[model samples]
Target: MNIRFDLRQVRAFLAVASTLHFKQAAETLCITQPALSRLIKGLEESIGAELFTRTTRQVELTVAGRLFLGECQQAITHLERATHLAQQAASGDIGHLSIAYNDFSINGVLPSILDTFKEKYPDISVDLVYMPSHTQHKALLDHEIDVGFLIGPLDMAGIQTFRAALERIVVILPRRHHLADRQQLYIEDLKDEKFILGTENGWREFRQYIFNICIKAGFTPQVVQEASTSSGIFGLVAANMGVSLYSDCINRFQRDDIAVVPLDHDDYSVETIAAWSMSYTTPSFRLFRELLESRLGGES
Candidate 1:
């Protein structure tokens, strides 16, 4: 037998099945009881089956009605899911977004990115992975992450990059240090200081920047310690472990025992970049990149 199914009939079936009363179902569906009764009668005739056993006092489902109700429930659930999926796809919210960035990005830029992205497309679920700059680059190469926020001069093949911002590196010192009283300090002033550096192996740009600045100022830094994160490095500095070079964002850590001093030299700045695998540059990723570029003042 050829049977036609309409969404309206499915909706009417679900409403009547749930309420077990034509008057109640009509009220829920915002239609009159007579109109609802007509719809249900047409639906039952279309399927060539009796869906309800009605009496003067009460109405109940027949065996066929019970089975049809189950099918109607499943159909309604699938329809709702389909509608949600369609809406998500229309608004660029259905796909997976794998983002990799260093810990500094989380403190400095991620909050704004998340806020804007959520406001624009609240259904797009994002997976954020934090790694050192080198590891983020490697993950992008491996196609494990869709986008990367890295501190550069990155020279990697098969990756497309756009420079975002140039962030000035600052010296983090114990609040009681004598140099902390100065508004700014030159690299030469820190020549004899025992320096704490973060991520010696993975943060090539920052690690090299620190070493080169110290060498240009006429002495090798006396290395006192190494840490893998901004918080750890700043925590060590706060405890007076040693002075450390860090980005301006580290000041937001708000540790009472630590103070930030600006570097007097211009070359100590690090450039942040947005990078992605050349192969996975979809329109959605491009739009996201544009959003980031706008935030960084690099949008064309």
Candidate 2:
């Protein structure tokens, strides 16, 4: 038994074991009858057992061959499954994606887009991380997150950005406030009001944009209070801790005490974009990009 057994020999054995006919097995294996006989002989010689019993008219597996057949079937099935899984992974049909998002994104178009993605690519598992825009931006650079739903241009080094959506910044005002019923609130109108601004460590681009809007209106906002949470911000606004600016989609958090009113200026909007570190462009990333493009259509 110095001869070695290989996959082709096992395959030849399985074919012969299955049909129990040398001529038919040779046809199935696309080999000559003599060649098939040689392979089965080699395999039986290596195993030191007679795998088949033959009369001129019929062939049959011995007890040993029957047991070996079960094991061979399992081995072939497992090998086929491994090959399939590898192919699926390479095609980005099966894998894990680490995604980061802020409050604005999860509340707005992100949910619908995610639903569509799930329908198409069910095998791709998503790891959803919640963080503010600044943190998400930093995480993308550090390779902690594969994709980020963030605000602003995010024109930082090594980051590729795709603007996903643009939503107007709306005012979150106490319902009883005089300006709440107005058709639209101008940035100038809130100059004297004690504004509830975002904390310094939060959305940097958005905070600066709001400041620029206030500066254009001839006065800086008076920051009376600060909170990092969206629900907390809404609570603050409901309490009249002062009105604040938020993307219009967050009006879903509207309350009896707080009113959502749009800004008068057309430029007063926030850009929700997708960002990734340059190295993270994989098939999973392309699937996510396609989902956004499908939903927004020319907007992404």
Candidate 3:
């Protein structure tokens, strides 16, 4: 009566209540009969109620025991269910994740990664945001987005970058262009041709990468026009406004007015990285990273 009671008492009481026998309940609970008896006595005394009636040959629940039993069973069930949900959350099996992506990533590697990830962890609710790399960088910094699939090198502080895909730069020219019939085009081939490119916000680092590629090819490209959207870039190229360089992934969106040709250069590939705040650590983010990394490896 003077002893403290806790979940141990509740468990012992449940076992004995279910079996209506101390020796048998002790066996089920892996405890000594004496310990089980003490636990039941303490729980009864602490609650100021006799939960069971005992005789020389019989044990039966008291009226109070019958009523309390249902609630106790519910309590145990709820506790077990809550524990399971917590474990799932810790393991990245269930949660919400906000992922920011660029235009090229949406068309290319992101879809496969998302499909595989959703198939494996269907409980996770994902919010996809279409944004440029520069905007995504700021969102990552502010913790607005969980992660970003964008072109690199981000070269920013407080951000961790993982290589998600190696995207090859391809040439998108008008179907009737003299070079359209060529199987593959080199950077040198486009040196003299006018270029259609994304605006600064659309691809800051990637724009520089493109410029470097042209510079590496021994000539500066003449960017005669700029388009903010991928579809707009295609429209510009289709109209014969200028030829453009885009990720090989864009070939999925085939246009009859445009000729998609692969680039034949050693440095034709651009590295697309998964970027996140270095300080932010979430199981959902880790799960996404692992799945994306696997998808990227399979792609290569």
Clashes of each: 0, 0, 0
Q: Indicate the worst ten consecutive residues by lDDT in candidate 2.
A: 291-300
Local distance difference test scores for all models: 0.79, 0.83, 0.85
The C-alpha stretches of model 2 lying farther than 4 A from their native spots are 1-93
RMSD of 1: 14.5
Which residue pairs does candidate 3 place in steric collision? none
Whole-structure CA lDDT of model 1: 0.79
For candidate 1, which ten residues in a row score worst on lDDT? 77-86
Tens-digit lDDT track of model 2 for 1-300:
454799999999999888889999999999999999999999999898999999999999999989989888877865764575578679976765778988788988688788888888888878898888988876886567779998867778888887788899999898888898998988888988988867777656677888988898899988889887778888899898899999999766547889888998778889888888886465677888777776676432
Q: RMSD of each candidate?
A: 14.5, 17.1, 17.5
Provide the lDDT at 244 for model 3. Answer: 91
Write down the TM-score for model 1. 0.66
Task: Compute the lDDT for candidate 3.
Answer: 0.85
Per-residue accuracy of model 1 over 64-174 as CA lDDT, tens digit each: 999998777766765664575577678877654668888667777676886897678665677788778888877787666778988876778888887766778899999
Q: For candidate 2, report its TM-score.
A: 0.66
Q: Between the candidate structures 1 and 3, which one is better when assessed by lDDT?
A: 3
- Model 3 earns a TM-score of 0.65
**Residue 277 of model 3, lDDT score:** 90
lDDT of 3 by residue, 149-202 (tens): 898767899998887777788999999999999999888999889999999878
